[model samples]
Target: MAIDRATAALLGGALGDALGMPTQLLTPEEIDRTYGFVDRFVAPSDDHPVSRGLPAGAITDDTEQTLLLGRVLLESGAVFDHRRWVDALVSWEREVKARGSYDLLGPSTKRALDAINAGASPEDAGRGGDTNGAAMRIAPVGIVMPFEPLEALVAKVAETCSATHNTPIAIATASAVAAAVSCGVAGGNWREAVDCAEHAALRGANLGDGSARADVARLIRDARDLVRGRPEAEAIPLIVERIGTGVAAAESVPAAFAVLELAAGDPWRAAVVGANLGGDTDTIGAIAAGMAGACAGMASLPAGRIAELKGLDVEAVRLLAAELVAARFDRPDGRVAA
Candidate 1:
């Protein structure tokens, strides 16, 4: 049977997260010295800051939080329930801490959740956040929403991201990723998907708190243009030096687009490149590979690796994808495409 676009997207992001797990925060040189081009899954380095002691093919907070958010989305349907979301995060964090993994929430999300715990409103809690935490785990939003008539999709992205990353840059960048995934799920080609992402970025910029330092749409365009048709030797350095692969939305999101462009929408290739990209590798891989998966579908990835995913419920992920697709088309406004 052919794999569905939604399933492909969710699995692809997880695979990318696992592939990049061992190399998440290492510099390129250190990655080369330790693991020598991490094209496959490997155990994290012993002294690794966040994911130390994890075995090969193990996922991090990226996939875990994604699945958690997905469950929340399923429960609430179209309307976002901030209370449910907060409860879910708190529970997930507690579980993660119990597991003794240092790979907890990212800075922006941690701070926002802390503020919320301290009695701040959800709307105000994330006002200062401007990182890629929103974008990294936003695939479910794209999976359950349509990209066309872009405003609706952008609105959904904003609503979901508001509690953890309410700043303009965070929302705008995440909207771009969500738009690409939605366009790709609709069977659009990579070029069309990226174009939709650009428009979504522009639309999302005005929805969140605080001003963005740079034009996210233009940055994505520039990132794509920088890597298009370039040789790997030349392109990788350019991406690392100019575009960057960091925790900031302005950096990692655009870098992910550039990596997607470089891989020509190949989910496996995109994930590999993202894993080897140095700083914030897992997030870059998750975002880029999620877009690639939506365009290419799950069959494009390795079956053995997918089967090797131990703790994660692969079946549940696929079922969630199908459910999200159903809910997407059943929206009251009839905004979804047939």
Candidate 2:
């Protein structure tokens, strides 16, 4: 039997995160030189900024923040109070700082936290960078809000993201990814979920923090067109050169979607494409592979790879998925889920 979509999505993201961890910041040239192809989960060979010295199969901030969002939703009964999220993140960062961890947090998060510490309101703290930090770990938002109307979902997304990535592109890209996950969890096919996501992206791109430079709508359009029928090898280089795979939501999110489209929703394949793309490998892999896993169903990932993922068992993820689904259905407008 297939694993539940929720379990699959979380585990798939964790798998991609671990697979791409070692190669996170390496140049495509360096990735080729160092590991050729990252086939299994491994720790960073060199100090790769965000995740140095992490054990093999250890997750990065991508999944950590994703879980944090989930925790907030569950604890708060599905009500999205931004201040609660702010407090939770402050505590999370405090712990991260206490651990003396490296490569664990992004620049945008660091800056936002600093501003908040300096007394900036939570609403205004996250207006600096427009990176994919918000998108990388936003799956939980989708999991919890799958049934909310699109406008409502988008509003929640805006609230969730504005704390650290209050830009149009970032929120839209993150919403698209989350919407895709929601559609998948609801039994939409990969194409169906992508379609849902594209629509959300269109609506989201129309609004923003007014400082973004990249036209996310155009980038996604070109990205989808560029790899519509291309193979992975051909798509990887082209995407790297044209679409890029860095911290920008416009770049990484679209790149992940293109890889998913090209790979036909194979979680592992999509992840490999993103991981091999060079920059922001972990985030790319996390988003693309997680979406692919959800849309393609749990069995879409390889059994071998699933077995190799550590610290994130399928059963545990499945249990959480059940809780989230129940919580989603349990909630009423502006009320906590049962």
Candidate 3:
């Protein structure tokens, strides 16, 4: 049987994160030179201090922050508690800092959290930022809020994103990702899912300066036109070049969507293609992987690749995901009951 929606999100996010870890910083050419198209998970290099040359299966901030969001949501039950969300983020930062590790906190997130600690309102902490940090952590919200009305879900995502990515583009991008994942779970087609995300993003974009929105919108249009009847290899670079893969929400989110559009039914291939594209590989992999995982379910990911993800609370994530699905579907005793 296919994995449940929640388990699919957890495993999808974690596996994508772990797969992209080794190739995170390498340029596409360097990746080509070193690994010649990364088809399987590989160990980190000896020079890399993070994993100490550990074999494949090492997850990064993508999965870590995703789990943090899951934990917060599960604990908060059905309510969208802003203070609890802020507290959870701050508490996680403190705990990570105490351990002398900055593993889970993105640069933008760290800056926003620091500003929050230094007296900026949590709502204002990410005022000018526009990074993929918020988008990377958005999968759980999609899982939790799948059945809600689209506007309600978008509003909650914006609220969640405000803590560390309040810029219009960042908020829009994060909401789009969450909305796409949620739509996928609801059995939307690839085109329908992308359209739902585009709609959510356009709504957020309209509320701000709108330049980033225009850019992503144009890229999505162009990507759709370009990928018709083309192989993923022919289409990936065109979209990435036109849309970009930088950590900016505008750049990364659309590139992910393009890859998803091109590789609609194959989550593993889509993620691998995104990861090897270089330039924000992890974020690309995370975004694309989340969508594909939701659409295709966890079984779509290869058994070998799933075996390679490292350093995550796998069982906990699975349990939380199952609980979230249960809650959404009105099961007798999901995590909300406990």
**Which one is best on TM-score?**
1
Please tell me which model should have the higher TM-score, number 2 or number 3. Answer: 2
Cα lDDT tens digits, model 1, 1-338, are: 11399888889999888999889888888899999988888898889898788889998888988888877887875577778998898777778779997355788988887888789888898888998999999988888887766778888888888888988899899999999988888888778899999999998888888755569999999999999999766888899999988899999999999999999999989999999889999999999998999988867888998887646899999898887787677865523333
Sort by lDDT, top down from the best? 1, 2, 3
Order of models, best TM-score first: 1, 2, 3
lDDT of 3 by residue, 273-296 (tens): 777877777778877878878777
Error of 1 at 84 (Å): 0.8
lDDT of 1 at 91: 77
- The CA lDDT of each predicted structure is 0.86, 0.78, 0.72
Candidate 3 clashing pairs, residues 3+ apart or interchain: 57-308, 57-309, 57-310, 58-310
Model 3 gets an lDDT of 0.72
Off by over 4 Å in 3: 1-3, 48-55, 98-104, 206-218, 330-338
Q: Show where candidate 1 strays beyond 4 Å.
A: 1-3, 332-338
Greater-lDDT candidate between 1 and 2: 1
As a whole number from 0 to 100, the lDDT of residue 213 in candidate 2 is: 50
Give the TM-score comparing model 2 with the true structure, all chains together: 0.92
Residue range 167-187, candidate 2, lDDT tens digits: 788888888888888888878
